[model samples]
Target: MENTTTLGCLVLLCIFITFPRTKGACRFRRFGIDCRYSCNCPGGCNDVNGVCRGPCYPGWHSGNGTVCQTKNIAYNGSTKQSSNYYTFKYLSNKAVDGNRDQNIYDGSCSHTGLNKTSASWQVNIEPPTQIYQVKMYYRQDLRKRFRRFTLYLNDVDEEWRVCYHHQKDSIQSIVNVNCNITTKTKALFVYNERGTPETSGQSYERHAYMELCEVEVYVCSKGTYGDCRQFCYCKDGPCDFITGQCPGSGLCENGFTGQHCQTDCSSIGKYGVNCSESCSASHCFNRQMCHRVTGRCLDGCQDGWIEPTCVKHTQVVPCHLSVKVNSDATELCIRSL
Candidate 1:
């Protein structure tokens, strides 16, 4: 009877281990067996395995895509601001050092000069990786210092797209924004437009300042969309990060045709934009063969045909008759070809 009871207990334990009781679902940023582990991952974490829902936060890496470890992508990047406040102690690189200390005196935040019409901060991510999201931690004591600020993505010197904008006067100490850009860029800007409006006409209210505590820029190590598991195969630039489709209003690259710009124009003896210009139709000399880029005839034009493009007929001189007046005698001379 004791042996029988032991066998029944083993069966009961197996069932209990196989089916643990469900206690609702774990909230965002929390994961574990009992939902106890917590980390400030921007894309959240999986409830079952504690892996990051997206890529690990900037300045962080996941060896197994589950544990967030020390690897500073943002800290390695360079930073600069419009102006430094007071002294050089409050440098722009402090914001990206992976420190969240709100105290500027603690050497973890960035500050700009006072009474400025506009203020800006920019970070240069070397090698130009895909920017999934940006999170800014502002100084809580002086939240008013940051108003009407905007986030922009830059390629070299040009601002290609706007990541986010703050329209309200009142904001929290921390702000998170998703960029969702198709192509990768090298720079990012946190800018305040020129001439801030004054609420009470105070001198401080007429200007803007950049007082950032910490800045986090998230990027996937590999894929772009949907938990960073899928990849894009576009010929030029990149496809939409989320949709995995070609960007730029359905426009394809030169010498390529189709929605994804995958088909080669040379396969059909065609060239130019969208492969609309055909080499055969252009009268190429080498059996309608042409260069894919310039659409020029490879072996020159056929007999009596133009050299380039081979589309026009060669001009031919017609027979002519010339009439001349002699100065010595009052006689007319006619010369025939």
Candidate 2:
């Protein structure tokens, strides 16, 4: 009987090996659905995990469900350079107003207030951003005046880090600058100090006019603007850098709460980038500001308080019965400790 039982077990093992489960393991689709294997790649990516896949759809991710995320391109139709326009002969903001018109006959040549010996045009990328691609279009008609321009990233120490420099070269052409500038910066500068070959520091030469039809600053890689919020949680697809909007889970980063994750989590007991940190109700001993991100007491709780945003209490007093006399009048009273 024992021999028969062993033989039965062997037969069962053979059967299991002959008909192994093949979900995600089948290699040949020619064998039909019963033999087709699959991976966790997005609906279209057939590459193995961790391989550098082709660029996903614009504003989308490979692992994500292909939902278009917001790109972090520098020009959002709102981000402009400094309010200090290059005051040339009549040039002003129109030159850098993001309008690309080659029609010098219609004032495109002088729209940005031309011919300044010392002038600067800068763009604010909000909290400073690592810019990689910078495209500056010289006023089509006044291209000759855009000679000798330099690009810089403003550092926190108030120093300018020169990224690109253009010599007194051809005018009336689009200058596309691509570089690896991966530093978080507050602003980018277009410092054009060179005037026409004859213009001086004190005087403006009509040939030395400096103007740009359009200044477009963009991030290098595709499918991203500056950076995504915590990788957009990488759920459904990705997040938009400019808008702070995500796809999957429809959730924003910490310290932020809203449909689009645009509103910060600010009230009485909270503060931080994500806004999810909780501050102490009584301020952790009643005399200190909690940490903005961790919500810990900056000055520590008083004597009898817990940590990590807990309440504070002096101490619990015991109750006692006692007799007291007021104004020579003896009376029995209950005193609280």
Candidate 3:
């Protein structure tokens, strides 16, 4: 009787394992098995095949049955901004160092105010995808009495400040800041606080100058998913969502051509068919018809002729030849006259 009971339990276990569960089935509790497919899980986290293990997190999504990935977003801008402070201005001046003309500013300050000189050139960032971080590059000029600076994102009101203090003859300093870029427009504001009255009246004798070079923005889809954004040329192919058309490369497939790969090559002359074969050959020797294939004279002249159509002779013979006669003959010798 005990063996019989054991066999029955085994059969029951097999049936539970092999059979498919109905809707709202809690196999995790029924069979004591970590459920691979369960609609009962929170957020409809399809745990089918045990591979689809995790729920689609807040910033993530799953398309295929088992593959969960982040989405891709694109950002559009003429210039990429950097977080490094030295990339602001003074982008390698030629009058400074012999081998390298660029100079670094070295001064000290407390906290003055923001400088808004570059307000005309508005930066429009349209992300074809989502973005996460933004980096900027900047440097201070020593002659200007380098000091502290502030960065403003999107607008002047949103700002972050950093300080620098250490008097030196001349030096260059760089700073990098990571910030979020959720909007289309971003602004940069630099504050020159070299010698403020509140801190030290010593009066920093230099005019603080800042240089910005480049800015880079990092993007992520659905939290940390998708491809890192890149400036694509879209050459010889369809225009990417960011840039309009492909650049520098040949036209896309089919009949496309030209710089933007927009010209159609369908009408271009091809071999055989109705296309003119010898139409481009220059008409030499006047009206002589040129062989379509060889682009040479068809039935015109063999050689030696020089007329426009090889119809006239270039060489002719005179009617008579010149002969020498004796002038001092004896007595009017006209015997045969």
Candidate 4:
């Protein structure tokens, strides 16, 4: 019994020692009535990339370089992918490292050198970013590579949707290819492969390769960029970078979202940024304290409202050929004379 007790104590001690050093997620009131996640940690917090999250201290605070720095998702790896072959697979992902400069002496790590023209490079960005453009700095030493290329962005369906394609006529030097896309994507792809129009028109075109010295991907600002259904902002108020919400109702102190919460939460069934959430009220009609979504019904249909759409159901022309439509169908009404 003593031996068992000792072993149990040791196990407990090991667990305590090995646990990740993170405080439990906490929430507390802001200005006495508002609640918010505690960003004012003693040390620091991990961000979306699982690294130390940073920015400020508390109440218009100060910091090193962590503040004013948002996300640079191009270099971060968070996608699930497998490639048959990527040019210069020896040391991949050197292009998106935010370093576009080249070294003449040591040209090895400066770029990718794929032998097969069919090679490709891909990366996933997680949390679907709103991309606008991609800038590529091809290898200057080679000077002739990546003239013809294609860039793709992933859709909500996770497909490698082609957004832009480039075809160059001459062998330009020190030229940066800028492709404008402006779409939401979780995956990004770059290639100089088959099916993308061979420039030389030679059979050797099949053996073409690519050397990307650097690549810069730009995303649309969530507050004012693409997929922002509609946002609300008073005077020139900015929005939250992470949530795309503006701060505060033009009057309420809870803070706004989407274009500074300028996005209307007035939808009958949805609310929040881009109206992404369902209402919390069970029956909007019965008014049993609805969800954070202003108009959504948490419970079943209340009074005359229906599921999903929390608005009062008024009789209207049926859209489908169902029993309701048949009952209301008249020869003249069907013919629309």
Best by TM-score: 1
Total backbone collisions for each predicted model: 0, 18, 43, 26
Question: What lDDT is reached at residue 281 by model 1?
Answer: 75
TM-scores for the candidates: 0.48, 0.39, 0.25, 0.41
Task: For candidate 4, write residues 4-80 as lDDT tens digits.
Answer: 99999998798556432222332331111111122232445433111224443322122233221223456545322
Clashes of 4: 26
Whole-structure CA lDDT of model 1 = 0.68
Regions of model 1 farther than 4 Å from truth:
1-58, 61-65, 69-72, 156-159, 193-204, 223-225, 228-337
**Which digits, one per residue and each the tens of the lDDT, describe model 2 over residues 1-337?**
9999999999879855744432223442111112321222233332212112334433223334332222334443333332333444335444445456756555543333334456566656665665666677766655655666788887665767888887645544688886555566676777665445455433334433345566666542221234321222222444444443566666555544455544434334565655555564545754435544456554557665554344533333333534343342223334564
Error of 1 at 82 (Å): 1.0
Residues 1-337 of candidate 1 have per-residue lDDT tens digits of 9999999999879855644432226786765434544533677776644566566565775534564422335664799999999888888988888788987778778999988888999888787766776778998788766767889887655666887888875788888888767567788889974464544334236777898988877654321334434333344555554455676566665766765555556557888887888888766767557765567776667776665677765543332534353332223234455
> Compared with the true structure, what per-residue lDDT tens digits does model 3 show for residues 239-284?
4322234534533433233444333232232111122343223333
Q: On a 0 to 100 scale, what is the lDDT of residue 333 in model 2?
A: 38
Which of the two candidates, 1 or 4, achieves a greater TM-score against the reference? 1
In terms of lDDT, the poorest run of 10 residues in model 1 is 325-334
All models, RMSD in angstroms: 26.5, 21.9, 32.7, 20.7
Q: Output the worst ten-in-a-row residue range by lDDT, candidate 2.
A: 28-37
Ranking by lDDT: 1, 2, 4, 3
